[model samples]
Target: MNLAGRKVLVLGLGDTGLSMAKWLARRGASVRVADTRTGPPRLAELKRSLPSVPANSGPFRDEMFADIDLVAVSPGVPLAEPSVRRALDADIEVVGDIELFAQALPERHARIIAVTGTNGKSTVTSLAGAMARAAGVDCEVAGNIGPAVLDALMRREDAGRAAGLWVLEVSSFQLETTASLAADAATVLNVTEDHLDRYRSIDDYARAKARVFSGDGIQVLNRDDPRSLAMALPGRKTSTFGLDAPRHAEDWGLLERGGEPWLAQGANALLAVREMKLAGLHNAANALAALALCRALGLPLQPLLAALREFKGLPHRVELIGEADGVRWYDDSKGTNVGSTVAALVGLARLDSKLVLIAGGDGKGQDFSPLKEAVARSAREMVLIGRDALLIEAAVAGAGVPIRRAASMDQAVALAAQAARPGDAVLLSPACASFDMFRDYRHRGEVFRLAVERVIDAPKH
Candidate 1:
């Protein structure tokens, strides 16, 4: 782990790349940066913080890989890139920020709780962090959910605070380059088709997520997802969470008490589903996963339950935005893949009413056929938008739900409002990327919220 006088090349200049550069430079590593973009977002900040480090932009140079001892890659930069492949061919040690953070963990004396899956990673990570803090444990949420792991490490070191616990929301992309993150507790919440553009197949994607269980840590898996359950290794300690009743004494699940669902560990009911502030059955599953992860570290159950009861789920993921004409509107712009949209749709299905779904974006090469069953059962109408609207329309064409296309978010919201009945809900859960029409998912959610507000303020006819 000693970097004194070692040469390192930082590939990409995003937040992760910048953090890698800062961390490497502080360890006295001779650092140089190369980014595919002529002007990366963090270029100015890089110049200000570490002016002495050499930075080259636009088309990666072959010479950049020469004389470099290690290549610290940002998750956004694929390993298949020519420059990265060249580095690998040259026998240069290539790693990511997470790997570096893992290698440095011993000095910090912190236990790690790693969470990864195609969906619900952020929700589970946030809730677990909240549970730990409520129980008076000093912990920091990092990785994909907050500041970069290396940035968090530096902040904790500078503050002279003990790194009590680290709750990380890791993505499959990060997992590809990470090797040494031996979390005290880890979970692959679920695995579904996502990032097909980068991976050869769904199996490839799931295998990358499986890396979270590389160490001798307790594995918390989703019983409902066969892919997640299949990750359990022989002789390794395992825990499970699902919407149905728990099959084992130590596992987590839902139970029926007085004709209402309650969160249960084994046959013992802990809290009623109605007591949780977060909406939807999917969130209940997320809450159970968080509880399992926290409890694996032996964190007390009382504070964890307190945190779950008070937690108001993350924004842009099944968040209720407004209500008009007795029709509720939700912003689930964070549903950037088919799995997330399916979860949201199935979780919000109601017997008395249906959903007017606003979906479609980049699609990311996902098979949208999985959405058909949920749409057929839960959605009254589907309003498609963004680049892959036609693809989704075709997928759900035989689902018996009427499909409409819109060129913009505002138009999509209007169409959904028109299609929704008095008791129905409008859900913006695009199972695709937002790059086609918006900067990101948060921007897309904001636009959807504003459009809903406009419709709510329009004078009644």
Candidate 2:
């Protein structure tokens, strides 16, 4: 907690790293910034933020670890880097910004709602914060979803702090370097295969996410996911969220009445499932997780449910972009892993409509096998793109669906339009990262929208 006179290295100059470097330097920690990428995108911003702090532009140097007391790693920097390992060997404690934020919290403390999972972390985190704001609670939503956790911590310190809530969207990457993060309530929405490039195995990835429950407070778990349910530790009060009826007094789930489902806590029906604007049963799980987190922190349910009804959902996740030739097109650029895309395919499946799926990008060393079953059930055809297109094709080969390949997003959209029928949905739910053909996922989604617009606005033949 005592940063003064400590020598710290801020690894990777992404937004989190820059914020951490600035914070540490301001607090008198001897800070140095380093990135593997030569001239990282944020290099200029980093220099402006902490001009006095020395920085390295290329690969990490082992020599830097010699004098460092602690290394604050940005979430994007993999812990497996040789320099990080060298730091560990040198007995230099390595931690992320979240850990630093935890160490900086006031002694009396504010309620912490830590949300994590492969998918819906952002939606649930945002939803929880909206719920708190709707209930008139002073809340800060940060961590991976907004400003860095350390930035949020500094802002709270600058203000005349009051007892409220801090809702955090914690990713596995952040969780890997975090310790001492004892939340008032924590939940891993659901754990599925993701970030296989950085992790040794799927279990390792899940283990990092499960650490969100390390605190002595309540653990909110996804009852439907075996991986998430397996993280419930002994001696911790646990609550659950899922599609089935609640099985315990404190559980949040769904109930069927008059052939329609309602969100319920135990036997009490809170709101009809139709009342929520979020699409898919997966989103229902996210809503339940947010509701459970709020109830765990003693927030009013009515206000939370009200916020849920009004929440329009985040962009790039099952977002409807345009309609053309009687086909509905959806953009799910955030579906960067197999689990997320699988969930989307099933969640958006309609009995009266077939799906023409556009997928493939950087596979990130993940197995596309899980996506096979869902694609077989819902997708009428698969239009592939990016580096791992053939890999996905091989995995979904036995599904009896026709597969096509496109050289670019525009071509993919055109192929999808050609294949789509009147009731068919054209979905760009790439089950891989966007780094292959685009700058990032947002760029991928933007390009998809532009391509769809071109298709829609073209002359009708």
Provide the lowest-lDDT 10-residue window in model 2. 345-354
Backbone clashes for every candidate come to: 0, 0
Query: How does each model score on lDDT?
Result: 0.93, 0.88
Model number with the top TM-score: 1
TM-score of 2: 0.96
- lDDT score of model 2? 0.88
* Superposed model 2: Cα runs more than 4 Å off: 161-163, 350-352
Q: Provide the TM-score for each candidate, comma-separated.
A: 0.99, 0.96
Residue 291: error of model 1 in Å?
A: 0.3
Highest lDDT: give the candidate number. 1
Give the 10-residue window scoring lowest on summed lDDT in candidate 1: 344-353
